[model samples]
Target: MNGSKDIFSTIFSAGTFQMMLRSATPVALAAIGGSMTEHAGIMNIGMEGMILMGAFFGVLGSFLAQSAFAGLALALLVGILAGLFFALLVVRYKSDEFIIGCALNTFAIGLTTYLARNYFPGDASGNPNLPELNLAFLDRIPGLRVINHQSVLVYLTWIIVILAWLFVYKTPYGFWLRASGEKPDTLRTAGISPKKMKWIASVLCGILCALAGAHLSLGQLQGTFTDNMSNSRGFIAFACVIFAAAHPGKAYLAALMFGFFEAIGLRLQGFVSSDLTGMIPYLITIVMMVYVVVRKQRRKMKNE
Candidate 1:
């Protein structure tokens, strides 16, 4: 009973909530980007590679310019250029999106790993910790104080969530993006280029995903760039988009849920085998995917 109580206390502690938010932020941001691409009829699996590139370039830029802002700007540019490349292949050349996505992921892994070894050597390129803002007033509000002392990325993620939701549901462009996926013929008849809509979605997704990667390196990990630091969070974000059915707000919530599990896994490391503990998030991801698939099957059957 005492052990149970201790476990409960630890899990519900303020530190846990803070960790949850930190873990969730990058995933939430990437998921929001994934939602845009999914709405535009694209299943982007290259997000992992995109995230890795962003992390590498973020550190590289900081190392070069000695300014976090400069690093961020460069990271965004790299992400945008990567997105453009993807758009050109998928939209213009009509390449197989899946093949291109896989190629990107492989290329990112190879390129980043190579650069880290040759240039950074042991991932010690720069120290570019994002400033953490303290919201002391929230301390008086009990649990709300747990959210204080977070990085700018945390707040930015919430703002992006709201904006993404509004853009997807309340804006004309959102309608066009959705229509392009649902009925390209109808969109074409309306004199709108579905390809153009795809380009916008891909570019936006790249920027957001890059931001997510930046947060991983600069904010969450405190400006430390490791080879493959992204570590499948991009894929998890993609899962969140699918679980949320392409809704931005829902995707963010799904990311938060995954983050909670991730926090739990971190906490459990002391109590369980490290290998088993490491499997927690991936296991949960598989379960979530299974649940989504089962629910979808049920709905399809009912419709039939």
Candidate 2:
């Protein structure tokens, strides 16, 4: 009992909260993109591949150009190209998104692994990496100051979150995106092609997922690519979409919830086995998904 209390105490500290924000950044970015695709009526499950590719390209661009901005630009370009490929197969050809997504994931792993073997055979730290945003003025503030220093993308994430929320709820395009999924016929009457909307959404998902990968590779302290670096974050971001019903802000919150739990797992490493600790985020994901289903069932029963 005391041990559990001690663990909980350590998990809830400010340091852990800061870590939670850091860990949640990638997930939140992907979740936002997932929400966009979800609202557009396409079941995009290929984020895993997109993220992997982005991470690989981000590092490669940085290494070759010796500039972090070039790395980010490269990641974005790759994302656009990947999004177009996905749209061509799934949107244009009417292919199964799940199958394509799975294929994409497999291709990403094989491709990135092969490239990593060739390009990053050894030390990769000499290349420039994405720098963290250090707010000198915030240093004077207590409490918030400690957590203020994070990846530039981390700070940008909050801005993205706000813009996403605004874009979804306050814009004509947002209505069209949601309508394309929920009321395609109605959207068609308005003369906006649902297919066009789907293509746009898919590309947006690709961009955001790519950004997530870039952040993973260069935005964080690791600042390097590893084999299979995405590590199921794509799926977790999808879970966040479901848990939040495709709401961008809510999805971010869900990602934070997962991040918090994962942070706990990381902290728990000292107290327990690494294997058990690794299960924390996955376990929370399962619970969240189960809860969504249970809630839906309960709502159905109540209506009946």
Candidate 3:
């Protein structure tokens, strides 16, 4: 009974909920951005690279400028440039999106690693850690403890998610974006350029993915940009985008689901073998992917 109580307590702890939100923020942000590209008929497999670039530059800017806001701005600028470069490669040069994406990932990792080693050897792991901002008044409120002791960026992510949902579903521009993907020829006939829509989507994706990176490095990890710190969150975000069918709201839900399992894994780390605990999230992802594939197959069969 004592063991059972302990297990239950761990599962329902405030710490666990906090971990879930922290883990979910980056994935949700990136998924929202990726959804934009998918809506515009672009498969942006370079999201990981964009995120990696953002994380690296975020720390670099913060270290150089000694200000978090300046760091974030610099990261955003770099992210936009990366997006334009990706667009030029796939859209203008007719390069294969998959190959270009792989190249971009490699390029980002190599370039960032080189820069870190040469310019900021001490910060090779990232910049000085970011401090958590707490809402003091909110902390005084009973049951609002969860709302305090969190980075300001985490709160901002929630706002971004809501705004993304509104942008995708409640506006004429959203309609144009969807039309570009579902019926590009029609949109072109309507005098809306599909290419331009795709470009916009690409830029939007870059910005959001960069924010996701910023959240990971600055908000959660406190300004530490370790080599390959992205750790495939970009891919996980892609999976979230697909699982949610490219809807921002649904993507956030999917991300939360991933976060829940990730939190469980962290909680179980001391109780279970670290190796086994580490496998939980990946295993869950595989199961979810299999389920998605099976559902798609069944739907196709029904149509046939």
Candidate 4:
């Protein structure tokens, strides 16, 4: 009993909590981007591809420029181009959005793999890693250890979340985006172009998703661009957006829940089967999606 208590206590400690927050940051950032696209009525299933491209290019940029910020800038630029390509396929040509998304995912996987193999070669890891924002002075204060030694990007993510919330709820552009999804005709009548809103949303989504990928490859891992490194984080981000009904603030919370599971999986790998542990986040996503469906059905029945 004492041993079991100790194990549980260890699992619930402040260090564990910090680990969970760190794990959740990337997912939360990507989910916020996804939420923006969903709010504008665009189903961006290409998030996985965007993330992959970002990770690949981020490493490439760092390797070539030998600067983390330059790498991030390059990733963001590639993401914008990718977003524009997606917009051309889905919005302009009216290609099947789902098909285009899948193609993008496949293309990203193939292209990144080829580039890593040919150009970068030899593990294809990033050159210069982004530095952490260590606040050693804050360590003098009691109970501030957890907040002091985090990466600068993590703090930036927090600020982005708040700003995203405000952008979605308090700004006119946000209103137009929401209207584009819920009532496109109304927006058009009001002289707001739904296509333009969706384009902007797609571009912004790409930038944010790129940042998330950069966080994974540059910020957290510190230089590694493994194939499929994103590992369906894009899908999980989509789930978060759905779970939160496209609300940025709520989507951030949902992402944290997923991140918590991921953190648990990482922590439990030593004690449990790593395969089973890794499935925790995906399994939880399936369960949450089912719950949403059931709740919607029940509400429909009640209304009827």
Instruction: Give TM-scores for every candidate, taking all chains together and pairing residue i with residue i.
Output: 0.94, 0.93, 0.92, 0.93
lDDT of 2: 0.87
Q: Candidate 3: where are CA atoms >4 Å away?
A: 124-131, 293-304
Model 1 C-alpha lDDT versus the unseen true structure: 0.86
Q: Evaluate residue 130 in candidate 1 and report its C-alpha lDDT on the 0 to 100 scale.
A: 74
Clashes of 1: 0
Query: How many collisions per candidate?
Result: 0, 0, 3, 0
Q: What range of 10 consecutive residues in model 3 has the weakest lDDT sum? A: 122-131
lDDT of model 1, residue 297 = 100
Ranking by lDDT: 2, 1, 4, 3
Q: What is candidate 3's lDDT per residue for 126-209, written digit by digit as tens?
A: 465556766689778877787678777778888888998888889878888999889999999999998888888888999999
- lDDT tens per residue, model 2, 1-304: 9998988888888778888999899999999998998998888889889988988898889988989889999999999899989999998999999999999999999999998889888855556788877888887887787477788888888888899899889999988999999999999999999889889988888899999999999987456888899999999888889888899999899889888877877777889775776667677768878888998899999999
lDDT of 4 by residue, 14-132 (tens): 67667777777778888889988899898889998898888888888898888988889998999899888988888889898889989998999999899989876678664787888
Please identify which of the two predictions, 1 or 3, would achieve the higher TM-score against the true structure: 1
